[model samples]
Target: MSQFNLTINQKKYDVDVDPQMPLLWVIRDIIGLTGTKYGCGIAQCGACTIHFDGKAMRSCVLPISNVGDAKITTIEGLSDDGSHPTQVAWKEMDVPQCGYCQAGQIMAAVDLINKKPNPSDEDIHRGMTNVCRCGTYNRIKSAIKLAAEGGKS
Candidate 1:
């Protein structure tokens, strides 16, 4: 086991773990942050999406040793009061059915908005590849548009 320092959601945590351990496990099991989910465990599914240095990344396949100094931001860190534009838009648009994939969806949406700011429908369709088995794509698209529009009523 080796000790590593991780800065997650602006909080710093030092942990002793195996180098081969995936960041997903570190975030969920070691650090005790369960907001990031486990889906395919292979990186095919975006269910474990999180921000690494402001870029959306799949945590399940990312080894903790590879994390280095990148700042990690999980869905829990998206907002202190759950008022992030994407979050507000999600609530206003009622984007989740089963809600299993919303966290990853929101995280991916945050990255999309940050990158595109005013993403077109095609841009959204191209950018958000997170799988939602509940098929809430319409609402997710609407929420992304709403968020891009600054979450206006």
Candidate 2:
């Protein structure tokens, strides 16, 4: 077990884990943060998406060694009161059908809007590709629009 110190959700954590262990395990298992899900373990699914140094990344495939001093932000840390515009827009739109993937989806959407606050429908469709099996694409689009209009965030 290698010792590593990583910051998460604005808190510092020290863990003794295999250097090659994927960060998802460290976050969910060691650090006790489960908002970042483990959907496919492969990076294909966005269920484990989190912000690595304020940038969205697939945590399931991220090696602990690669994280270094980078900051980590999970769904819980997205907002102090869960009132981030995207979260509020998602609630206003009722976007989640099964709710299993909403966390990752919201995280990705926030990143998209951070880069482009006023994303067009096509831009949202192109930028946010985190899958939802319930296929609430239209609502997702609407929520993003609502968020862009200063409706939520």
Best by TM-score: 1
Estimated TM-score for each candidate: 0.97, 0.95
Which pairs of residues collide in model 1?
Answer: none
Worst 10 residues of 1 by lDDT: 144-153
Question: Which regions of candidate 2 fall more than 4 Å away from where they truly are?
Answer: 151-153
Whole-model lDDT per candidate: 0.93, 0.89
* Candidate 2 collision pairs: 85-152, 85-153
Residue 149 of model 1, lDDT score: 90
